[model samples]
Target: MAITSANQLELLQTAEAVAREKMIDPGLVVEAMEESLARAAKSRYGAEMDIRVSIDRKTGKATFTRVRTVVDEEEIENYQAEMTVEQAKQYLEAPEIGDTFVEEIPPVELGRIAAQSAKQVILQKVREAERDRQYEEFKDKAGTIINGLVKREEYGNVIVDIGRGEAVLRRNEKIGRESYRPNDRIRVFIKDVRRETRGPQIFLSRTAPEFMAELFKMEVPEIYDGIIEIKAVARDPGSRAKIAVISYDNSIDPVGACVGMRGSRVQAVVNELQGEKIDIIPWNEDQPTFLVNALQPAEVTKVVLDDEAGKIEVVVPEEQLSLAIGRRGQNVRLASQLTNLDIDIMTEAEESARRQKEFEARTALFQEALDIDEFFAQLLVSEGFANLEEVAYVEIDELLVIDGVDEGTANELQTRAREYLEAAAKAALDAARALGAEDSLIAFEGLTAQMVEALAKDDVKTLEDFATCADWELAGGWTTVDGQRVKDDGVLEPFGVTLEEAQDMVMTARVVLGWVDPEELVAQSEEEAEEGAEEGASEAEA
Candidate 1:
C-alpha cells in the first residue's frame, strides 16, 4: 500500500488526487508544487543551482528546469580549461564563460525522497488552512452550547464531532454517571477551542456548573440578548442546581421569566440537564435574605457569618435541619456555591442560644420585650431622635419643647423606655437560646478564644437557656473569650483586609462561581466616579 516510487507523471496525478480529496484551492496547490520542486533542487544540487518550476494545475502538469553554468572547455573535459564554440553550442548559441544553460530534468528521478518531502509540505499547508477555518467558526460560539453527535468514545471519554472537528467530553463531565453511545445526540457547552497538533480541538462539557446556565441562554431570549441575567449558578449535575437570577428591568421577575408558565422555560433546561432539578432563585442584594432562600424547603430563622472562618451559620427550624443540610450536606453544599458562601447549617435551637448571649451584652440598649417595634424604633431615629434612651429619660416638661413630644407621647415614651429596660432581660433569654451572639457584636479583643470555645463546645441546648448564662461555666471558671483576630500588630496580613476589600473579593467570587455581571460593576464604577468628582469639586472650592 505504501508507494514510494513516484515520478513526474505520478507526482502530478497524486497532487491532483490529494487536491480533490482535501478540496484545496487549485492555485494554492500549484504554489505548493512550485515551491516544493525548488526546494528539492536545492536539496539534491548546490544552492546556486537555479531551478524554476511552472505548474499548470489546470493541465495537471509541472515543468521543472535547472539552470547551470556554461563552463569553459577545461571544466567539462580534461583536455582544455575552457569550452570551445561546438561545446558551448550544446548549452547556448552565444554562451560566455559564466553563461547559464536551462536543462529540464525528468520527473521519474524524483523518487521516494522528493515525493515524500513534497507530500509532507502539502499536507502541512492543508492542515494550517483547516485550523484557521475551524478557529473562525467556533470562536463566535465560545460561550454557547451546541448539540453534536458522539463521533467516538475512548477510555470512558466521548468525542463529539461538533461540525468542524471532535470535541472531547471527559468521563467526569458526564451527568450523574450518564452513558452515551456512538452517534448519540447530546448538547454540550463549547467550553474552549484550541489549535492542537491534530487539529482544532474543542473542549466540551456536560457536567460543568455552567451547563445549565448555557441551556438557559438558549431557552431564554433575554439571556442571549442581554436582558435578564443569570448572576450566579451552582449545579449538582443530573440532581439539582440553584441559579441566582436578576433582571435589569424592575418589572421583569427574573425567576418567573426563567420559569415559564407551567414550567415550560425551565423544562427545556431540565431536558438539557438530563432530568436534573433547577431552582431559579431570585437574586437579593441582601446577603442574609439571599442565603435563606438559597437553602430551599427549609425555613431559616437567622444567618450568622464568621468572616474569619469564612463560614456562614444558618439556623432553621429543628425539623428543617435535615432538609437544610440535605442528605449528607447536599442542599447546604449547593446553597454555599449558589451564594458563594461557605455555609454551616444549624437548627433554630442552636442559633437562638448564639443570639441570646449577644442580647445580654448590648443590655438595655436592645429591647427585651418581644412586642417592641424595631421598625418604629428605626422610624424614630429617621425622625431625628438619635437616642431612644435619651427620649426615655426625658422629663414630661422637657419633652414639650420637642416638635412631636406631648403628654400622651411622654407616657408612650416611658413605656418605650420600659421596653428598653425589659429588652436587657429579654435579650438575656434570647441570647440564652442562641449559644453565640447572632449577628450582634462580633467577639472583640476583650473576649478570649477559650471562652468562646467553651460556649461553642458546650451542650447548652437553646439560646433562651444560653441567654441565662449568669454562672454557666464552660469548663473552668473562665469568662475570657478570645476573638478571631482580624489583624496582628500594626502590619496588614492577607486576612487583615477591610470590609470594602472583602466585598470586592466576594464580587469576584460570584463571577468565577458562575455567570458574570460586567454591567452592574460598570454602573457601580460610574457611581464611584460621580462621588469622587463631587469630593474633588468640594476640595477645589475649599
Candidate 2:
C-alpha cells in the first residue's frame, strides 16, 4: 500500500484501534509499525545501506532516510555505510570525521509479500504486549481469591478465564471430586503467576488450606475485622477439615462466631467446598489443652507430652479410641498437623498398664543400687523418685515431704547415692586412662568422668581424634549418614551428657589441644628463629 497524505489519518486510526483491543500502549503499536516499514524499505533500497523509518504519531506521515558517517580513508570499512572526508565534502562544507549525514528517500509502495510481513510483525508485537499486561495485572493477586469462568480442559487440568487473563487449575490442585464444564463460573485461589516464553501463566488451586481460610474471611465478619483470628487450618479436602481460632475480645467466642447463628457462616464455606465437613474449635495457648480441643468429639482422659521429641501421648476411654483415631487414623493425623505435634492415641487401660510396669522397674533399681529393703524402695518410688541421680542431687527437704521419712533417713539415702556415683565415676576415669587416651583429653577441663569414658570406648582416644570430630558428633546438630540427615543425639549419649555440656566439653578440648588458636605457635617459632640468628653471630665473632 502507498501511504499518501489522504490516507495517513486512516493509518493512525487503525494503530489506535489495535492498541485499544489488545490493551497495549498506542505508542508501542506505532513503533512496531515503523519497524515493519523500515524492514520493507531495506528490500527496495539495497539491504547493505543504513535505512530508518519514522511515522508521526499525530498524522501517521512516514519518513524514510539513509544514514552515513564521515570517516578517514583508513576507517572506511563499508563504503555504503561510511563516506570518506573528501566524498562527504560534496554534501556540506568541511564535514568532519565522526559526523552523521541523513539523506531523505521517497517512501516506496509496499508489495504483497512485504504487506504480509508487516501484518505478522504487528500481530506478534500485540501478542507480546497482551502477555505483559496480563502478568502485571495478576502478579499481585497471588494468594488471594479470584472468580473466573471455565474456558477449557486440557488433560485433567482446567483453564479458567479470569477477567483480563486466563489461569490454569492443575489436576492435583483441584478437589478430587470436583468437575467443571466450559463457561461455568468458579472461584479459585491464585497460587502463582509466572512469566514464561509462551505467555504469563496463572496457576490456581481449590484444595489449598489458604483457600478455605480466605473463604471464611469473606463469610465471617469477626475474622475480617480482626476481632477473631484463625490460628491454623488442616484439610483432608472434600472429606473433612479442622480450623483452630482464637478471639481477642472477652465477650466474643471464636468458635461460636465462626459457626455463626444456626451455622449460616460455616455452611456457606461448606457449600462452596462441596459439603466438606468442618470443625471449628477454640484455640488455647496451652499445648495440651489445644490438642484436646483439636481432637473434638473425642474425650481425652489424659495427655503425656515430650516437648524435645515433639510427641504427645493422649489416652482416651476404651470406647473413644475408634472416634479419636477416626477412619484410617484421620482424626489424630489432622490433630497432629493442626497442633504441629506428633500425636499418639491410646486407651486408659493401656496407659495404666504401662505406668505400673514403670513403677515396678524403678522400685527394683532403688532396692539393688541403694542396698535398701523392699519397703524403703517402695517409699522412694512412691515419692516420685525415678533414678539415683534425683536422690543424689535433690535437697533433703524434698525427701522430708514423704511420710515416715525423717531427717535421719533422708541424710542416709543421700549419702548412699553419693557414694555409689563417686565409685562409678572413679571406675570410668581409670578405664578411660587405661585405653590409651591422651592426658590432654583426659584432663580437659569441661569433660566429665563419664564423657571421657564414652569417647575412649568409641576409639576417639587421642587428642587429634577428639579435635577433628565434628561439632555434631561432639555436641548436637544434624548429621548426614547414608544420604539421610538425622539428628545427632551426641557422641556422649551413652554417658547421659546433656547437649549443652557436650558443646562446652568440645570447645575446651579444642582450646587445650591448641587446635583453635594458632597465635601461640606463631610466637614460639619467631622466638626460636631470633635465638638461632644470635647464636650464629656469636660463633662467628669467637
Candidate 3:
C-alpha cells in the first residue's frame, strides 16, 4: 500500500538495522519483505495481480506498486481505462477515449493485507541481490590478506569470523603445529574465495609451495625491486624446504642476499613459517651445474645427464653421499623438485669402477693390434721391462733397446696400432657424421694441403683424414709404393722433428680434422758438385 520514495527509505533502514545487529546480510531481510508482499497481494487481490516492490538502500524502508489490467467498457467501474475529459480537467491534460488513466492510491487506501503483499515482494529481491553482490566483493580478494576471528573448532577444522560471514580454516592450513580455540584472532591468506547461495566457500591452504613464495615476497625487499627472482621452490611444510634464487645484478650474489648475514633474511620467513628448515641455493640454467648447486653443502664431482628421461646421475665422495642424499633422501628429493630434475645419487666408488671398466676395454683393444701382448712380453724380458704400461708408452729409443724389435718391426707395429686405432675411431665418427654437415671439416685449422686433399675423395674422404700414417709416410722406412719398394734413410735429423712431433700431428688430425693422408715421400734428393772439383784439387796437390 505504501509505494513511495519515503516509504522505501524507511523500510530499507529497518532492514539494515536488523542485518547489522544479527551480523547477516541486509539483502536477505529485504528479500523476505518482497516475498511477504507478494503472498499478501495474492491473497487480497487474485494471484494474477503481479506485485513488485522496490527498497531504498539509504533507508530501512520500501515501496510497493500494484499493477492491474485496463479494460474499456460502457459503464463498468472495474479496471478503469480512462477518466472522462471533463473529470481529467483536474490536471492540465484531458483524457481521450483510448488513453489510459493512472492515479496514485495512498497508503490509507491499501488494506493491511495489500501492504503486507508489497513488503514480501521487496524482501525477496534483496536476498537474491545479496548473494551476487557478496561474491563480487570477495572474489577479487583471493590471494590477499584477511583478518578473521576463530569461531569454533569442529573436530580439527577451525571456523573463522570474517566480518559479515564465517570461513573454515581446515587444520592443515594452520601454520606450524599451532592449535586454535574459539574466539582467537588469526590472520590468514584469502587462498580461495568461492560463492554459494548459502554463503561463500573459502578454501584455505598453508602447505602449498606458493605459501613459501608469498612469505618471501612479504619479507624480501629485493624481490619487490625485480632484482631478485625465485626461480624455483619445493617445500614440506613444518619440515624442510629448498628454494632457488637468481639475481639480475652480478654485484649481488642471489643466494647470499637471500641468506642475509647470519641467515637473518630467510630466518624472518622461517620464523613466520614456524622455524621450517630452509636451504637456499643459486639457480643455474645448465642441468649439470644446477644439480651441483642443488646438492649443496655436499660437493659433487660429476653430473651425468639423461635429458630424455629427465634424470641426472650425480657422483660425490663416499662420505658425502649420505650427506647429499640427506636423511632418508630428503635433501636430494627437495633438490630434485627445486631443479625439476629426477635425481639418482651415487658414491665415488661406483663411478671409479665404471671408469675402470672403460679404461680396460680400451687397453685390451690396443694390445690386440700388432700382437702387442706377445711383443710386449718379449721386449720386457729382454730390456728388463716389467709391465705392459711402460712398453705401450715407451719412446722410439727405448724400443730400439729391445732385441729383435728393429725399426722395421717397430714401424710395422706402430702402423698396425694406428690402423686399429683408425678402425676404432671410425665407429665414433660414423655417429657424428650423421649429425654433422660439410662444415664438420672446417673444425680443422693447422691441416696441410696434402691432408685436406685426402679428405676430399669419397673412399678416403673421411678415412684418409683420420689415418695415422702421416709420420711414417714422411719417415725413413722404405715401403712398397704399388709393389715398387722405395727405401730411404730413417734419419729425421734433416727435418729437425722427432717421432713425438709426428705422433702429435696424427692424433690432432684424427680428432679435429677427421682424416689424415699417408705420409708422402718428401725426401729432397741432392747430387754432389761433381768430380770436376776433385780433379782440380788433385792437380793443385800434384
For candidate 1, write residues 4-51 as lDDT tens digits. 333445656766676676665545666776777776766666455567
Q: Sum up the clashes in candidate 3.
A: 37
Better of 1 and 3 by lDDT: 1
Highest TM-score, which number?
2
- Model number with the top lDDT: 2
- TM-score: the better of candidates 2 and 3: 2
| The 10-residue segment with the lowest total lDDT in model 3 | 518-527
Best of the two (1, 2) by lDDT: 2
Query: Backbone collision count in every prediction?
Result: 41, 0, 37
Which residue pairs come into collision in candidate 2?
A: none
lDDT of 3 by residue, 382-405 (tens): 455433334445676777766667
lDDT by residue for model 2 (1-542), tens? 98789888877998999999888899888888888888888888878788888889877899999999999899788877789989988886879999889989999799999999988988888888889988998999999999999999999999999989789999988987688999999999999999999999999999999999999999999999989999999998888999999999999999999999999999999999989999998999999999999998899999989775566999999999999999877888789879988788889999989888998899998988799988989889988898899999998999999988899988998999999889988998999988877777777666777788888888988777887776667655555576334566667765555556665566556767667665765686699999999999997885
CA lDDT scores, all candidates in order? 0.66, 0.87, 0.65
The positional error of residue 326 in candidate 1, measured at the CA in angstroms, is 1.6
User: Better model by TM-score, 1 or 3?
Assistant: 1
Model 3: what TM-score? Answer: 0.54
Off by over 4 Å in 3: 1-9, 15-36, 54-133, 145-147, 352-542
